[model samples]
Target: MPAVCAVLAGAAACSGVPAGFERPEQPVPTPEGYVDASDPQPISEIAWRYGPAPWRTDAMGDPRIEAEMAGIPYAIEFYGCDQGQGCTDLRFVTRADLRDSDDPDKPASRQARVWQANRWNLERRFGKVSAGEEPGELILEMNATLAGGVTRQNLDAWFDWWRVALTEFQDFTAR
Candidate 1:
């Protein structure tokens, strides 16, 4: 009995785990050069990087900015009760068509594959994806109120996700 207790205590000490308890796994660190979206600065940096974008007003008269990523154009729409409290939304239109058929109702296999690849890549980092007005357009939309207002981190993360998704989609759709 004494030998058994000594053995158990020795095992615990070596493993740094309590008796009958498992040690938790350490979290994997973020990859090097990867932007920490929650850090805030990355988002602002992206906005500055894409400066000189064309500006316009949305239907609600809110300001919007147009930019491009991976050869795809997108719009950044702002929404808020007042200028001081608004958030931004990203709208992206892909170059790929949903289908080659003339019928709008038919789903394009190639388009679907690209969309799925984009969806998988983006969803892992950002969130859910919804269909856009035109086929092949993807909207990674967020409501200011629901998202607790957009910050620089949000914009940075969106751009980062776009960069990754663009590469992924291109690879999947390559000839």
Candidate 2:
């Protein structure tokens, strides 16, 4: 009986599982045209960097930026205290007639796919993202607290990053 017990222990040790083996890595879908926000440009210097083609203030007087890929539009609207108070939040939004499908499940399923894909990419850069839907739009939004008091310099940097990140996200959704 002692020998039998010893054999069982040996067999257990010999099993294929490693002592610290974790689950296999699952494949994740990466958004096409996704840009890493490794090097961010300060907002104040944006005019000198990009030549000011698609960036402008919207009708509401908030800063608005646009990005397009495959003829699809993606926009970022910045909101915060007036003047150089700095932006506290930004919304990345896209609109599609997902509800046009006769089958109700189709829109919901598509929304879920977009949400999942964008969520994965956004989380990598900005940590947690709040995702949801409006009447005719899908939105992924993030809020941030500036390390220092809201200043024009910080706002510029934040906007610059948002433009690049939102453009990348828009490209991903276009695919």
Candidate 3:
């Protein structure tokens, strides 16, 4: 009985630190609020939070929401989605189509568009600016990771940041 008790105590102590390393703390999942983000219903609520947004399909047929931010039309897309497990990330993207002259004869220079994107990227931290595949198209994107889930307040704050960033970008472009 003494030998068995001694072995159990030794095992318990060894479990605390294995191979001279402390057990890493596990990450606590962010609490879910009114909606269970894991399900797709929260997506409609998300769209509702930002005004009237219509559901659309992306090129690949994945669900996309058309919403306007800072008076600019943008698409909200989901990534890392599993039919059984649900989506883990959400992205908001907009394409600013530019034309140098009112006349279709001339198009905006790629260099100018790239330069603008580079400037936006250098100046901003919330959203990323990039030159799109098409000429004279500038892309702005913001992404949110929902790996563990998020609180309603935090999610609202995230939307707030997106709006602020979009407004700032619009102002920047106007200049």
What TM-score against the true fold does each predicted structure earn? 0.43, 0.37, 0.70
Best-matching candidate per TM-score: 3
Candidate RMSDs in order: 12.4, 14.4, 10.5
| Candidate 3 residue pairs in clash (backbone atoms < 3 Å) | none
Give the per-residue lDDT of model 3 (tens digit) for 68-162. 75567777787766542456678888777655655555556888778888888888889998888897777889998766677767777777888
Candidate 2 Cα errors over 4 Å, as ranges: 1-111, 114-123, 127-131, 134-137, 146-148
In the range 1-175, model 1's lDDT, one tens digit per residue, is: 9999999999877977666565335323435554422233343357546443565566665556566665655555554324422332334334444443455665555566455647655555533344455755434433222132344565566566666655554554342
Return the lDDT, model 2, position 151: 52
lDDT of 3 at 140: 84
Which one wins by TM-score: 1 or 2? 1
Error of 2 at 60 (Å): 14
TM-score of 3: 0.70
User: In candidate 1, how many Å is residue 32 off?
Assistant: 29
Per-candidate clashes come to 0, 2, 0
| Residue 58 displacement in candidate 3 (angstroms) | 3.6
Best first by TM-score, ranked = 3, 1, 2
